[model samples]
Target: MKLIIGLGNPGKNYDRTRHNIGFMCIDALAEKWNVTLSESKFKGMYTVVHRPEGKVMLLKPLTYMNLSGECVRPIMDYFDIDVEDIIVIYDDLDLETGKLRLRQKGSAGGHNGIKSLIQHIGTQEFKRIRVGISRPPAGMKVPDYVLSKFSKEEEPVIEQAIEKVVQACEASLSKKFIDVMNEFN
Candidate 1:
């Protein structure tokens, strides 16, 4: 089974925040596949879907962003999933808003969520989809900025990016991840 994890803090208050783009993408995929993340365990909310290729698990870590790895590692151990068989989706402040970047391996680049993941998983080698939220404005704290909601002007763009992420993820289920990256990135 392949594991797709979207990083985010769980709660209604966090819904639609810039940092929750990962969750948004997972949600989009769930809707597309007509599945529900109705199961909860291992510090996450998830659902397993059977596709022609195999079983795919969509996960949203409920440990919030900083402790995401705590949630991920257990699920991976329980499922006997390899690091390569997992894909992590999260917000990126380095890229422009609504842009998407895919990498097979890389450092955390100061992202606490990724940092925690690397600490727990013991490797920087893993597939990742970075959905750009853009850097915070001058004088705006990073924490505050990440938790803020997108403006009406940004909503459509982010929605498009989320749709693109969903498509890329779906493609990865059948095609090699590299192929999906080539097509979508």
Candidate 2:
């Protein structure tokens, strides 16, 4: 089974904020695949989807952004899922808005959520899908920028990125991570 985790803070207050892009992507996937993330466990909300190639557990950590791994580690341990079978999707400030990057393993690049995952999971050998949110403008604080909603001009770009994330998730069900990276990254 594969564990696909989308890292973000929970609740309506965070909705549509740049920092919640991961949650948005997960929501899109749930709508596309007709699965409901109605079950609560492991400090998160999750639903299992059975595909032709394998079973995928879609998770949204309710532990908030900074302590995401607290939610991830337990689910992984309980499910006996290997690091390679895990795919995490989250926002990135390095790339331009709407861009996506895939990596097999790497540092968190200052993302607290990813940092937490790396620390709690005890490894950086998992796959990640980074949806770009772009850097904050001059004089703007990163926290403020991330917590803010996208501008009108950026809405379409973010929407498209979310769609692509859903496609990448579907492709991952049957293809290798590298292949998905080649196709989507």
Candidate 3:
């Protein structure tokens, strides 16, 4: 089974914010697969879907951004999922808005959520899909920028990126992570 985790803060207040792009992508996937993330467990919301390749568990952590590993580690342990079978989707400030990057393993690059995951998972050897949110403007705080919603001009771009994220998740089930990265990154 594959564990696909999208990192973001929980609740309506964080909806559509730049920091919540991960959640948005998971929502998009749920809609695409006709599955509902109605079950709450492991400090997160998740649902399992049986695909041709195998079973896939979609998870959206509810432990907020900084402490996301708290939710991921337990769920992974409970499910007996290997670290390599995990794929985390989250926002990145290094790439331009709407861009996506896939990495098999790396440092968090200052993302608190990824940092938490790396620490708890005790390794950085998992796959990751990074949806770009772009860097904050001059004089703007990183936290404030991430918590803010995208501008009107960037909405369509973000929507397209979310669709790509969904496609990447689907592809991961049948193909190697490197192949998926080559196709989408």
Candidate 4:
């Protein structure tokens, strides 16, 4: 089965934060597929769904962003999932807000959560879905920007991004990552 992991911190206050876009995307997917994320395992929340191709696991890691690898590695070992079958969704500051980029494999590009995953997984040869959150406002610390909740003006744009991200997840499962990138990138 393919593993879809959304990266984010775990807390009520973090629900709508910029850093939690990954979690938000997974939340939308769970809703669409009638899957519940309450089944906690593998250092995350997940649900099993059977699609035409096969069974799949939609996961939202609760490793709070930086130590995501700690959570993902054990699950990968337990399931014996190949790197190619893993897809991680997380926020990116390098691209414009609402932009989405999927890479089959590459460096973590300075993302701590991803960095952790790469270190633990012992490779960067895994798929990734990066949703841009845009650079933080000038003068603010990077961490401050990510942990802060979205502003009122950003709500609509972010909500729309979430919808697209959910669709991207579906597309990834459908084995249409290239098309998804073409449409959303």
lDDT by candidate, in order shown: 0.95, 0.93, 0.94, 0.86
lDDT of 4 by residue, 38-96 (tens): 77876787887888877778888887899999888888888787887888989999988
- Please, what are the lDDT tens digits per residue for candidate 3 over residues 62-88? 999999999999999999999999999
Estimate TM-scores for all models. 0.98, 0.98, 0.98, 0.94
Q: Candidate 1, 146: how far from true, in Å?
A: 0.3
Q: Model 1: per-residue lDDT, tens digit, 85-184? A: 9999999999999999998999999999999999999999999999999999999999999999999999999999999999989888898888888998
Kindly provide the TM-score of model 2 when superposed on the true structure, using C-alpha atoms.
Answer: 0.98
Q: Evaluate model 2: give its lDDT.
A: 0.93
Which is the better candidate, 2 or 3, if ranked by lDDT? 3
Error of 1 at 18 (Å): 0.7
In candidate 4, the residue pairs with backbone N, CA or C atoms under 3 Å apart (3 or more residues apart, or in different chains) clash, namely: none
Worst 10 residues of 1 by lDDT: 170-179
